[model samples]
Target: MEAKFQIFLILLAVLAGTALLARRINVAPAILLMLAGIALAFVPGMPTVELPPELVLLVVLPPLIYSASVAMSWREFKSNLRPIILLALGCVIFTAFAVAAATHYLIGLPWAVGFLLGAIVAPPDVVAPLAIARKLGMPRRILVVLEGEGLANDATALILYRFTAAAITTGLFSLPKATGTFAVIVVCEIVFGVAVGWLSLRARHHARDPQVEITLSLITPYLAFWIPEHFGGSGVIATVACGLYISWNGPLLISSATRLQGIFFWDLIIFLVEGLLFLLTGFQMRLLFEKSKAFPLEDILIATALVAIIVVVARFAWVYPATYLPRLISKRIRERDPAPNWRTVFVISFTGVRGAVSLAAALALPLALPSGEAFPHRDMILFVAFGVIFITLVGMGSGLPLVARWLDITRDGRDEHRAEHEAEIAARREVLAAALQSLDAITDDRRLSDEVVKLLRARHESRTNQLPDSLDPDAYDVSAAGTALTRELIAAERKFIHVLLRDGKITDETRRRIERDLDLEEASLSNREFRKIAL
Candidate 1:
């Protein structure tokens, strides 16, 4: 237990350090963390850490999915639902078949085993690619489609995986029955997820205490996930639905303190979860390497290369046609949504980086059949799955930025960003106007004192004055300069407050209250500055 605790601490340290270095070098932390884990695994005296499949599937996944769902804009998710489905459902199934065919014919694996490998490697990882894509400022729609697909694709892949595994174990298969069961799972999980979200929101609202609300927030995903999963469903869609429900409804019902504290808490939790996940994924290389001695090295290499190539080519083949063929066939579809730029489509196709979920799925494969015979090529399947993850994460993950640059997708997003900023500015002005009108009505109804009315009006006016007149580059430069000066002033104020405490002039509690206000002001300034530069 002590040794295990020590190893965990080491992993956390490496995670934090590698993440910082990755940020400094402008690379995705997932890429660096994986590489770091691999290197650490080979170090003499480094204890081998095997990532438990159940740990990832049952424990890690729910929170990651739920948090992402909560963060997603429900409106944007809805608008891009078609492409998301096409990629999540259609692309995943197509890729699985493509891999199964390629492996069965070329590599001489059984049909079920080949399909199992395909399902394991099919879904592009949600974390690594999005981190890189967001940094590259790929158009909003492409990110949405990618993130949406990532969120939901696992359910499709995992369900297929379960069915294939069961068929291999029992030697029985039924397409129609499986199809009906899949539909039922999807429908049931959706309803259950939404129900969970509604209950979670109401519970949090009633609690009112930030700590308790945050605790309930932490429990939300597991409740949404575990119940459906216990009954043989994937639990992914349920968690997603629960999160989306909370996201869309919780704004009005949730207390402000909970929102603020929950943001930091969730952000930290996700950071550690994602970083450790990638690192552990890298550590699995050592185990796979030790297991590789069981098979001819040449055969393992050939199979790995074969499966990796097939998954990559399969995505390109599926994505291009799936993107444009609908428009070519249906005028109604064409009229409603025009064909996206080819470059955007290419970026999406190029981002099919497999992640840890694939590894977990592979590791979760049963060790033996019911009759006690070894599972067919189980070790080889694990090898190929990890190989696919490494090849995609290290290969495609690294190349995504260059691909976006070559295709000039970031350049195309400039106008979209500018327009978005314009909309934001317009909304800000409109909201302030509404607030002022409400203030006037309240003042009249309450017969408020002149002093209170004047103070409220002045506060609102100051907030209005802070808005930039326009998104002109010069205006942004001036705002940036002013913000920098404001930060320096705040820093000086903080220093003076410390001195006051040192001199016994202010109590610790009084110092904290003053520091909190300064911190909020500084945070607001930083946020405004980021918005200006992000355009």
Candidate 2:
């Protein structure tokens, strides 16, 4: 127990330190975490950390999937739904088959087992590379397509994996049966998830305290996963559906306070989980090689290289047609969306980084079959999956900025902000119009103060007149000034409270009460800053 505790502490410390260093140097933090883990493996007397396969699939995946879904833009996701489906489902299936053929021909694995290996590495993990892409200021449209693909591909790949494994174990392969089960799993999981999300939101409508609402938000995803999986449905699909449903309704149902708090909470959770996953990948890689030495080192390296190359090439093969074919076939699509240039498609094709999901699936493979025979090349599959993750995540993540520069893909920042400001200006005008009409209706009431009504109307009119026809940085500059003023005021209040305590001018209880109010004021200002930055 003591050793286990020590190991946990060591892992956490390394993860935290490496993550900070990565941020300082402006590289993907996951890359540094993996490197640190690899270095630690060579250190003398470092304790081994083992992650159970079930723990990852059951515990780690739900919140990551749910949090992402909650934050995703459903409108944008729907708009690009066709391309997303093509990449997420079609590309994943194609890649799996392509990898399977390579593995069977070159590595001499059976068809079912070869395909199982393919499914393990099929869905590209977007968590690491997506972060890097966002930092590089990639276009929003491309980011949406990439993020949407990551979310949907996992469910697709896992379903294929399960079917392939079943065939290997039982020697029964039926395309129709697999298709039927796949449909049932998706439909049932979505239905179950939607029902859970609706109930959770209804409960949230009555809750007043931010703490209570936050707790409910945390449990909602778990229940979403557990309920569906318990009834023979895909937990991943259920969790994602529940998250999307809640995300769509949360802005309306939740208070501003809850939204701010929940955002911070989930951000922290994802950071820690993602860091640990990369570290675990590094640790598992070292352990797998040591535990199983069945194949020659040269043979293992060759197989790993072959599999990694296949994964990258297969994506390129799929993405080009996926980008252009729809527009060619459907005039409606061509008329609605702009045609994507080859440069954009190239970036998308190259940035498919395999992440923790692939590692988890490989690790989760069963050790023995129904006939008590060992699963073929289980250890080799894990090693190959690790190689793919390492190659794609580190290679692509590091080189993406250079590629973007070479492609010369720059964002139209001015136009984007101009459009945003126009929308905001329009919304404010509508609200003021409504307020003026309401004030006119109540102007004759005896209970109302004429002076107060006049003051309110004048303020609204002044604000409306200040609105610009286009984006003006000066209009939003006031927020930064206000933020600075709030910070100075908070500092003064803290000092005054300390002085009061030192001089015994106020009771401890009184000081505490006053400090709490100051804290709330700071939180409100912080929330405003957060919203501004988001815009």
Candidate 3:
């Protein structure tokens, strides 16, 4: 067995355990994985483990992003398309330039490498925002916007990174060519994504078996990702497109069982990918440093701080202006409601937590350029990007609640949710009442067994307390529904027992024993009741 594979297995277990623990504790797992990796690297008898840079993004991202896309609701993403695009594409470009400019002068790095660093760290982590938004129980609108942004931003950032890397390697930067390349990449990515998505939907339309359908859905993301990359398009975009397309079309084509099974299977795959990716980031950072020894530690530290500030500040610049621009344009053009509110802007801005992609891109930088010389500023770029991710994610992430409180967003949101929750409960209670009384009837047996009548009366009295006045008379009266539903249950049970007996699945002795058991309490059952009463 290879040492790296052994390390990989151990890290997998460690990350999975840490992730579960973090979920239980209601905190982000990114911090836990990073700490664990660093600890493992330092521990005795733990071989210094480093993941292959080429494998980090290639092996992990397609599944992670695809799983996230699967989990997102299509309706939510569709409704907030504008804001998501602005942040994912527009804000990404803005941030890239801001960071590039800041790093260019501050770090004394060449123009291309600095911009490459910017591009590398441009997109905030999809895993981070998606996890936090879900955990915080943010509104669907907010979550969808974040999710959509995360999904799209990576494509933009990766394209920029490619061009930036090319310029640095070749020492020839053409504005016209880069612009054309950017446009072409974006268009091709979208086209590929749509095509793949359409294919997924087509596959599901023809699939009949739940097992086969789910297996096909599991395969869709990788196919979408690899195909686009193969064709010089954005794999990330292709994966997202396919995931979104399949999910949207699933209700139309896929069976209920297939959707349910796919959710669980894909969720597990995502958990594994995300957990392993973060852990790998920490270890890989050390490898980049070890290989790029010419870069001084102080230089790396300073560059990191500079890039982190740029990333953080760039968000503020992009968010505030972009948030309001839609509203202004809407007054004349589309004439729609403006973008998010001021508080939402704050929430959105602070939610920019960098994660795996930035680290992966940094690690993916060529060890030596086409010139056969060590990649200039490669160590610094990786170190700074990692630092940006760590500080922004841990620093702002830990303080998110505080920021919300400071803006008075948390308290107001809590109160609103509380009221909304109470209303939902009230509504649900009404529904239950209606569902119950749906089975209500006027009893014809005036001389019904005294004990049975007395039990029925008591149950009816209990129903008044449980069922609110708003409920119609035919509402969720348990006793009434039970009276109607219990007979079906009895018939099913009789059939089951009869089937067993006829098939010799049960013996006469066993039947008698069961009959004796069931004869004692005659069950009180309902339409949905699936179990049987034993004698």
Candidate 4:
């Protein structure tokens, strides 16, 4: 028990170091974490960490999916639903079949085994590329489309994976039955996921404690995933649906305190889990190398290189036609949605970097079939899966920022800020108008004093006037300037407090209390400023 606990701490410490290093170097943490894990694998006294397939599927995946789902923009997702569906469902199926065909012909794997490999790598992992994408200042629409595809594609890929693995195990295949089952699983998962989200939201509304509500938020995703999956449905889809449903209704249903706390908690959870998962993927290298020793190293390299190229090319092939074909065929689509430029399409196609889902699916493969023999080409599949992840994640992710710069597709925040400011101004005016009407009604009552009514009306009118008008760009500039100045003042106060602490002018307790107040002010300033410019 002591040794096990020590090993866990060591892994965490390594993860922390790698994360900090990645940030300092401006590389995505996932790439560094994987590299760190690989280096650690050869170190003396390093414990081998093996994650069982069932655990990865059932335990590791649910919360990650939920956190992503809750943070996703429902409005943006719906707006790009058509292309998202094409990439998620259509592209996923197409990639699986394409890769399967390539594997069967080039690598000479059996059709069922080849398809299994396809299914494993089909869904691109959103975590690594998204972190890089945000830093690269990629367009919001492209980010939304990518996120939606990642969220939705896993279900499709995993379903195909299950059917292919089953075919391999049973030595039988049925296309019609498989198609019917896939449809049923998708529909059932969505229905159950929505129910979980709705009930969780309702529960949150009635809860008095913020802590309890946060706890419920943690459990909601797992419940969403487990319930549907228990009945032979895709847990991945269920978790995403639950997250989307709750996120869409969050503003109205959740308290401000609960929302803020939940965001912090989930963000931390995701960071730790995501970093740990990537690092663990690296740790699997020794095992993978051991398993592949029977095959010629040159042959394995050829297979890995071939599959990686195929997956990359397949995404480009699917993205262009899928993106433009709809607008070409449908007048309604053309009118409703303007086609994106070739640059945007190229970015989307190039940035299909695979991550945890692919690794998890590959690791989750059974050690043996039902016939009690070793799973055919399992070693080769695992090797190739990792190859694809490394190539795509490190290779594509590293180049994405450069591509964004070259294409001049980086977001400037002007459009987003303008729209947000307009909405804020409208809301401010509405509430102030309502306040004035209430003051008038109170002034008419016999119990209300003229002095109180006059004071209330003056306050409301002043506030209404202070709000920036939509037509006056100068008002927005002034408001933003004031917020920025306030932030500077807050920073000055923080510096003074630190100096006081450094000089021992105040006790640690006193310094902490003063700093807390300063922190709150800074936080408020940040929130206001973020509304104006933050991504």
Candidate that would win on TM-score: 1
Q: How does residue 142 of candidate 3 score in lDDT?
A: 65
- Residues 268-337 of candidate 2 have per-residue lDDT tens digits of 9999888988888788755866855877899888988999999999999999988898899999999998
Runs of candidate 3 exceeding 4 Å displacement: 2-5, 288-293, 329-335, 411-535
Per-model TM against the reference: 0.99, 0.89, 0.77, 0.88
Ranking by TM-score: 1, 2, 4, 3
State the displacement of the C-alpha of residue 225, model 3, in Å, after optimal TM-score superposition. Answer: 1.4
Name the runs in model 2 displaced over 4 angstroms: 412-418, 421-486, 506-535
Candidate 1: list runs displaced more than 4 Å.
530-535
- Compare candidates 3 and 4 on TM-score and give the better one: 4
TM-score between candidate 1 and the true structure: 0.99
lDDT of 1: 0.93
Name the runs in model 4 displaced over 4 angstroms.
411-518, 530-535
Whose lDDT is greatest here? 1
User: Could you tell which candidate, 2 or 3, scores higher by TM-score?
Assistant: 2
Could you tell me the lDDT of residue 185 within candidate 1? 100
Error of 1 at 350 (Å): 0.3
Worst 10-residue lDDT window for candidate 2 reads 526-535
Clashing pairs in 1: none
